[model samples]
Target chain A: MAFVEARDLTKHFVIRRGWFARPTVVRALTGVNLEIERRETLGVVGESGCGKSTLGRCLIRLIEPTSGQVLFDGEDVLALHGEELRSLRRRMQIVFQNPFSSLNPRMTVRDIVAEPLKAHTNMRGSELTARVIELLRQVGLNESHLYRYPREFSGGQAQRIAVARALALNPDFIVLDEPTSALDVSVQATVVNLLEELQAELGLTYLFISHDLSVVQHISNRIAVMYLGEIVEMGNAEEIFHSPMHPYTQALLSATPMVDPETRRERIILEGSVPNPANPPSGCHFHTRCPAAMAFCADEKPPLREINGRLVACHLHE
Target chain B: MTEPLLRIEDLYVRFRTDEGTIRAVNGVNLEIMPGEMFGLVGESGCGKSVTGLSILKLVPHPGRITRGKIWFRGENLLEKPESAMREIRGRHIAMIFQDPMSSLNPVFTVGHQITRVIRRHHHVSRREAWERAAGTLDDLGIPDPERVMRSYPYELSGGMQQRVMIAIALSCGAELLIADEPTTALDVTIQAQILELLNALRIRRGVSILMITHDLGVVAETCDRVAVLYAGRVVESGPTDAVLQAPAHPYTQGLLNALPRPSARRKSLQAIPGSVPGGIEEIPGCPFHPRCALADDLCRSKTPIMTPVDSSGAHLAACHLIGKSEG
Candidate 1:
């Protein structure tokens, strides 16, 4: 069995309107199936409302999935409750999208890093302080920054601190959600390098979620392309970029602006925005904007099938 | 060659904050040739936007254009009257910003807002203005121009809203369009469409564009000429291909090297250490020297002036080690 396996994961958020109006259910995740081997990163790439983050959050049971089975080392993640759940949290951690918003304004850096250790373990006094110091050093911080608030640090530094907190429990798996989107290019690179170095050193499994394709391509061992809550295509990161199977994935890859001016990519601009997830289009949610969408795409949904070692979901493939 | 459409010389913008004065744009010089897309690329706090704003004298009240000469269409706009500058803002030079949601008026219909700008600048009746607005929106590839005109800003999607904003910009028939991260808020697919429209507008109407963005990819794909800004100064300036191909400034090199390229995966990104120095309290020597790997004792003590790399004077980089490294 894979180290972490997610089968038919789904999530629905009910947006409440006026006093008596009907609640609208936004189908954030329809059905997401994924697996990650030990010491590997599974990258989920998509646009803003595609539910890639929801899928990541669901895998760790951060948010309860409406229906799904997430198996971590042959144990059901959804079944755990109370004490078992708390224990599960120690082994499965998440780094949020924004470092500025994730860290508390009032808590000092030392307190922030030590909070997880205190909650999970019985470390107290000097041992706690020493662990916090060691964690800071591991993430490239020093003794002087121990008592300073998160506001004192730059975006890169704050993200490092967040990474340190995530590593406090020495978790086997960590979900990083758009961790570099808020940072500048220079700062983002440093954070990415740090994450890579940490993963290698700890032999950790990661569920890397990002809308930035290049960042995802850099850190991910396997890449999954999400469109309206469904994994349209997934395979090795290099293969996905080099020869994408799904039309949406191809459009996405071409849309990504290449820094190299020498190679001009054929532009494939998908028309219209992602359909309202609350009232998605019939059959394939991506059919509404897909350029090569056929008549059958509107009436019938396609199943993910292995094509040349890559799983693709499209009517063309069918 | 004829004089460039817009030339900025010794441009400096300062913001008086509680802490102190932040020199946002310091001794920056640039030129946008007619019918060309000039990209001003930089990270946040590098004063790319401020430089764009100072062109139309739109620097917010707290920030003042301390020193500069803005030459536009053979006239020094810095020396022009406030009324003249206002007349020139939309009539000759229009601007589109990153977030269309905020830039477009939420309360007003898209048509009303666009036509209002038309009535303000051009000598046209209400019907002609509405007709022109609809025509512009149609040109922008809005499915139903009339429906989009009637719809409020909130009714439109992010991509549609951006298209509406671009339509408004093109409504004035401006010569120069100052687009400051126009597609940054939209989806990548939508971004491609907007950039295509911008490129098309330049080709069809021969509009000179000053494109300001932090994304090197966007600059590389669209811009004909490029200028890299660092801490309110022009770190490098060259043809788009040359700047991306062979960057001389360490900051420029660092920014490119740090970017996660799609071609290669599972490689560690080259990160420049230390964040952009905060507070414009004029650091001694190079502004980027603190973070630059090539910084030496001399670079730390004295600022290096912009030096041309070739005989064409098209490519320039402000770095003390440029001469040493070239040989």
Candidate 2:
């Protein structure tokens, strides 16, 4: 069995403007199906409001999906309750974006990292301190940082502290939702390398979500491109980067500004922006901005299918 | 040769706080030629944004320009009175920030905000300013400018809001646009569109742009010339192709090497150790020596001055080890 599996997961967020106004339903996820093998990193790439973060939060049950099943280690995760859910939570963890805001400013590093251990385990006093220090060391910090508040640290160091806290439970799986996006390039590298090293050391499966194509292509074994709430393409990182099958994927790859001036490709500037999730286009949500969109694309929803040894969802492939 | 459009010499910006004096920008020098897109690249706390704010005398409270000469078209901007500076601001040079939502007035309609700026700068009638505002928006590829003008800032998407912001900035026919991470808040496709629009504006309108951003990719794609800022100083400056392709400073090289290239998949990235200095802590030598791998006794004791990398002197780098390795 795969380490983590999300089957036909769908989420709908209802926003009520006022008592008189009719509530709007935001279809954040429209049937997302994914599986991550043990010790593998599955990257989820998309723009803002595309449900990439929603997908990550749904996988960890941080936010309940309106429909569908989440299976971790072949066990039905959504059905668990009370102590059962608590035990399940110990195995799966998440590190959020914006490290400083994620951490409690009032709590010291030791208390912050130890909160998980204290809740989940019976370790107390010196034992808890020792374990917290160990976790900090794993993320490249030392004991001297134990008493400092989150405000005392820089963005990179605060992110390291968050990583240390996430590691407190010794999770088998982690959902990293744009962990390095809020950081500078140099500090982002430090966090990325640390995550890779820890993954290897702990044999952890990751659902790495980000908007950065290069960072995702580098760290991910398999890459999934999301448009609106659907996975438009899924394949090996190198294969996807080299030869993307979906038009949206091609546009996204071309749109990404590369660091090397010589490798600048002719950009496919997609007209207009992404459609509103509350009232997306009829068939493929991307059809409105898709350059190669056909007549049938607007009326018929394309199914995700295997093509050229990769999963692609487009009428062009059909 | 024609005179440079804008030149900054020995710029120093300092912030007074309870902790101490934070030297945001220290002895930075740069030159932006006419109709050229210049990029100032740096990580956070390296003083890239402060340098941009310094150009317009818009540094926030508790912060002041300690020392600098901002010469625009051979005139010292620092010597201008408040009245003259106000006249110079929107009339000659305009600025757009990273977040359009915050920068724009939410209470006013897009048309009202744009026309206000237009009328403030030029002696035109209200109707004429409104027409010009709509025209500017239309030229920026915004669809149905009439309808968009009626809507408030909160009603528009991030991309549209940014385009509206650009419309307001360009409404007065400013020659130079100081864009500080203008596209950072938008999505990639929208960012590409905005970058294309900026490049087109530079080409067609002949407007010089000073783009301040942390993303090197953005610099590589849009900038004609680039300056790499480190600890409030320009560590390296050259043509975009040369500086990006063959970066001479260790800091610039470290930054480029830190990025995860598509070709170098799963390979360990070379992370520069230690965080950027707080800018309040005094360092006698090179500010980057603490993080730089090739730091030595000379780098620790003395700061390096900008030296030409080759015969042309167009490309320059400040590093003690620039020629030492080759020798």
Query: Taking the true A–B contacts (Cα pairs closer than 8 Å), what share appears in each candidate?
Result: 0.85, 0.91
Specify the poorest-scoring 10-residue window by lDDT in model 2 chain B: B281-290
lDDT of 2 by residue, A167-194 (tens): 9999999999999999999999999999
Q: Which residue pairs overlap in candidate 1's backbone? A: none
DockQ of all candidate complexes: 0.79, 0.90
Task: Give stretches of model 2 more than 4 Å off.
Answer: none
Chain A only: give the TM-score of model 2. 0.99
Q: What lDDT score is found at residue B277 in candidate 1?
A: 71
**Residue range B1-327, candidate 1, lDDT tens digits:** 867999999998999998889989998999999899999999988999999999999999799998989999889898998999989988899999999999988999999999999999999999999999999988877899999999999999998898888888879999999999998887898888889989999998899999999999999899999999999999999999899998888899999999988765678888888888775567999999889777899998999999987777889999888778658
* List of chain A TM-scores, every candidate: 0.98, 0.99
| Span of 10 residues, lowest total lDDT, candidate 1 chain A | A258-267
Point out where model 1 deviates above 4 Å: A262-264
- Candidate 1 docking classification: medium
